[model samples]
Target: MLGEFDVGGQQALLDAHALVIGLGGLGSPVALYLAAAGVGELTLVDHDTVDLTNLQRQIVHDHASLDRPKVESAAARINALNPDTRVTTITGRLEGSELDEAVAAADVVLDGTDNFASRYAINAAGIAAKTPLVSGAAIRLEGQVTVIDPRREDAPCYRCLYGDAGDEALNCAENGVAAPLVGIVGSVQAMEAMKIIADVGETLAGYVLYLDAKRMEWRKLKLNRDPDWPPRGGGGGPGAGLGGAGRGWIELDKYNRVKKPKHPWV
Candidate 1:
């Protein structure tokens, strides 16, 4: 099993707690893989119900689970896969203190959510909790995955990448998504989380992975902390920026920070 790869890694995964937000397309594969891999505890949060359309990409739910709350559907599937994994389900959207409490209780948080507002909220909570975040997104045959570790001084949080970009809702309901694209992104997210928790392999703390499914190509981009971004663990307070960079006002460098792919296939 996992012990052959990393000594005592199986027990390490069994001792970890993970909090997952959203149980849709990306979440489906993330939750399934984590449970199958022996994560000790899981906190699942999702407000939506299983709809007929979700079956296209949400593999955790089936026709039997139609109209059921997504958390319940996902929990059932997880239990069926691994009864040893304990699951705590929250069936509604979490905000404010609730989100903070959940993030604080977990060793790692995974964001399978679809919108910017939810991502921003999760980022703020992860920063306050000093927890690592594994984030994934998929829509219209494209996907992206990134790991945000607030504990790292140079690692960029989600806000640093999309400052002031109001939540422009883009989802599979409105934009068509490839059936297997979410699986690819979500599986990658789960793998990153496992590596972080087990303290094995090189984590993607400062890199964002971009997937172009249509062309079957992948790109990796380096991320930088926004100079004006609030200090980590400061609870949104102002402090000396990373590298002692002045913080009156700084322009976001997301557009210029992305490194073009040298080789199309990796």
Candidate 2:
């Protein structure tokens, strides 16, 4: 099997290192496909556990894994599928110095997390590390995907399309999400990650692909390179998206207080 990938010119993918955040709907498919595609090293980050409801969309976690940490469960599945692919599990949020280190080590970072804070953190880290970050988001029937290569002079980042944490919308927990919707986005994320690592295919660096499952339509949202933004920088404090504004904190806290028992996706 290893020989098959090596001889087929897929050796680059097999030797590639990727970091995947969140082990839910999007992360599940991204992780599974990347591992099966023979990525050499994969790091799965998620602090949440497998709730019974997650089984609907988080296909990586089975009924038996209910109540187990999502990252651990997802890593076990990846190991079962492809032992040649090394899996590392980080059982917490990616923040502070820890976030910087993870991004620095990854050849490509895949964003499957559902929250704005985590997404922004990964975006800044991608810029700091100058690694390509493939990001995707899905809720209800809508999905979007983008690849950000900070090293590319023409690439647009996650913040360029949407502001930082300011006025960020609710995630799947509050609004609910469809199962297959994330699958579509995750598959695209996996594709972009592969292209970024193999240095082939036209990557989605400056554009966002939006999918509407109900209508079965695909929209490509183009983003221009913002020269005004930092061409080289670290952290989301000053010139970051939304200018370091985080108005979502208050509503997020309130929502957590009410839905803490019902939903545990964080």
Candidate 3:
């Protein structure tokens, strides 16, 4: 399996560093594939515990992981799949200085988080560290993926994309999601992460890809940087208040309109 990928670049990933912010649906596959791809170091941060419902899409956990910290469950799976990759588990929420420290050491940060608050923190940290971020989300049969490079002047940061965090958001518990949707997007995240580290292929830095399982259709949207967006600071600037200002952040309600066009996807 490893041979099919760039073998010469294996060391790049093996020596490369990554951080996954959540261990739920999308996080599971993203972490698993990166580990399997031999990413040298991976840090997983999540405060949630595993529940039976997670098994539907969070394939990293099994019957044994129920009631266990999600980070531990994911770490064990990654280490078992690829002993070469170093796995670190942060068994709680990452915020403020701690979140900054975790993201500062990574070459890429995967936005597997489900909420806006965490997403905003990851975005600020990635921008501060000038690291690339691979963001993915899946709800129902739909998924989206985008890459944000804060170091690049033309590419927008996460906050530039979303307007704000506190308007109204759906927790996964309230909103339903499809089982395989996250899998598909998360695997794509792993691929995009490798390409970014290797400096190969067309990365999803300036575009967003949306997938609909019910229709089995895919759509690519062009994203342009918002010139008026403010830098990372929790203030009242055009972009300051928004969650993922420069990076590609989705407005769930807006997305649902185009992604579902009928019933709610999530």
- Candidate 2, residues 1-266, lDDT tens digits: the string is 54433444388888889999889899999999999888999999988899998999998999999999999899889999999999989997767678889999999999887766567768878888898899888776778888889888766676565543343366687788889888889999998888777766588887767787889998775665444467443224222222233332232222211122222223
Q: Looking at candidate 1, what is the lDDT of residue 218? A: 91
Question: Stretches of candidate 3 above 4 Å error?
Answer: 1-7, 232-252, 256-266
* Predicted model with the maximum lDDT: 1
Q: TM-scores of the models, in the given order?
A: 0.86, 0.84, 0.87
Candidate 3 per-residue C-alpha lDDT over 1-266 given as tens digits, one digit per residue, 9 for 90 to 100: 34535676776877899988888888899998898877899989888899999898898899999999999999888878998888888987666788788888899999887766666667778888888999887765677888888778777665555646454555555677888888898899989999988777688887777787889998877666666655553433334212334343344344531121121111
- Candidate 2 has which clashing residue pairs, if any? none
List per-candidate RMSD values in Å. Answer: 7.3, 5.9, 5.5
TM-score of 1: 0.86
Pull out the clashing pairs in model 1.
none
Candidate 1 displacement at residue 218 in angstroms: 0.8
lDDT of each model, Cα atoms only? 0.78, 0.75, 0.75
Q: Write the per-residue lDDT of candidate 1 for residues 66-169, one digit (tens) a residue.
A: 99999999999999999999999998878888889999999999998776567777888898889999988777777888899988877787765555443234
Q: Name the weakest run of 10 consecutive residues (lDDT summed) in model 1.
A: 257-266
Runs of candidate 1 exceeding 4 Å displacement: 2-7, 167-169, 231-266
